[model samples]
Target chain A: MSKEWIGKTSNKVKNTVDRLLVKRFAESIGDLHPIFVDETYGEKSKYGVNIAPPTFPRVFDYGVLEGVDLPMKGLIHGEETYQYERPLLVGEEVYCYTIIQDYYERKGKSGDMGFVVIKRVGEDAKGNIIFTEIQNVIITEAVRKGINV
Target chain B: MKTMTEFKPGETLKVTLAPVSRLDLIKYAGASGDFNPIHTIDEEAKKAGLPGIIAHGMWTMGNLGKLFTPFLEKGFIKEYKVRFAGMVFLDDVLTLKAELAETSGNDLFFNVKAVKEKGQEVVKGSVHFRLYDAV
Candidate 1:
């Protein structure tokens, strides 16, 4: 079936890199890279500023609806792809808009399920596109007894 | 014994992951839209059989970016893949170590592993990066 959902989130005014936030994000992922925390080390890098790690964008909660509700269970992460228009620098206010780009139903080995594609675009203060992330999530009903998909 | 090939395995790099807090996990949930209670709510996580709110797999993968930046200057990571193994509990220290696996032409590949304080491997994966010469 051809179905699509679209949603938008406004810009968030962030004056700095939010060390505590970035640090926590890094820590959760078991990251030990000093550039994320050491300002001096980051300053010497090619970016000349504390650059948020590549997956840093995933930390923003834009609240996009992809025809699904919050706390979606049994949601398996199928694939993820990222495209960067420009490098992200610290202390820049940014915003992201998420949309349900596409969806389809398929018959798997177990049974039938649906696949959803979510797209999120992050933009800077000047409305320049910084990056775009596309994630595919598979939604299926929990097995009645002892089947796995 | 010298092998026929001219490839050499790069040095190994180790990084220690510090303890993670609950607040940190919440932020990651927001940023990633992965509101799986197993990662955000401790009570639910415990009920679900996980020791505590576990970190997102992608978040762990992101850490590798720092390791590669020094080698591939002005290089954008074209792709990365990882396979999840064990669970990561809150406040548990983790470690990520990598060794140059091999090189194909100008592409550099590294085999990386993430483990917990107990020495349990949480994830094992490989990353490929494209290198560009300075202008």
Candidate 2:
């Protein structure tokens, strides 16, 4: 068990909330909401700037934590949650990093399963917290065995 | 736009998504930076022990947020949560539903979910949002 990772935090990754990045994410989800795509609409809206969709941060990369042995191929995204201080504004620089919140194992029909809880945090240039996303990743017994963890 | 007072608790909203395709998944991979092969190439999916390529769980969850797009001006989504109940495969048509769960002051709480054509829930959760006036 990679219990040592429970308190590990990854290095921060900087992301510019660019317009095109927001637009592409909106399009991929089939949501063409003007607030996310139309700059003019965004300019006139309450936000005064285009905002990324609520789930947009899923795209941001949180730099890797060294020595983590989990395999990426078979891990399942079991659950997700996002807590926002406010919507991410377009063009604002966001620095994000991930922390391993917890880890536990359970028995399942197929085999033993390990659940990893990770919290990814984003902050503004001043380092004020912007949003926090907590996601649960599941590793099946086979994948764990392959890694010999 | 429906004002916070105008929306009654238990009011439900629904959005039916077009069947998901491989092209859509490919585009999502490019946009979201999650290029895990199980969500794209069939061969890679097979190697991962899946029957075939499956859609990214984020793709489906992202679409579920669409149920509240119309309310963006009223308020932004302060919180969105979901549990991935099952895998979403290519060409699977999904239906998203959200029912107003409660209202307090400017905050609106909703119970949301995503279901496939066969009525299987692929994702289900809740959304918490507050009105702009309350900000």
Clashes of 2: 0
Best candidate according to lDDT: 2
User: Residue A22 lDDT in model 2?
Assistant: 91
Single-chain TM-score of chain A, each candidate: 0.77, 0.97
Cα lDDT computed for each candidate against the true fold: 0.63, 0.91
Per-model i-RMS in Å? Answer: 3.8, 0.8
DockQ of each: 0.27, 0.86
Q: Pick out the ten consecutive residues of candidate 2 chain B with the lowest summed lDDT.
A: B1-10
Regions more than 4 Å wrong, model 2: none
lDDT string for model 1 (A9-116, tens) is 333433334666676666655454666656787789766766666677776755545434523455566666666654556666777667777777788886776677
Residue A26's C-alpha lDDT in candidate 2? Answer: 94
lDDT of 2 at A53: 89
Best by TM-score: 2
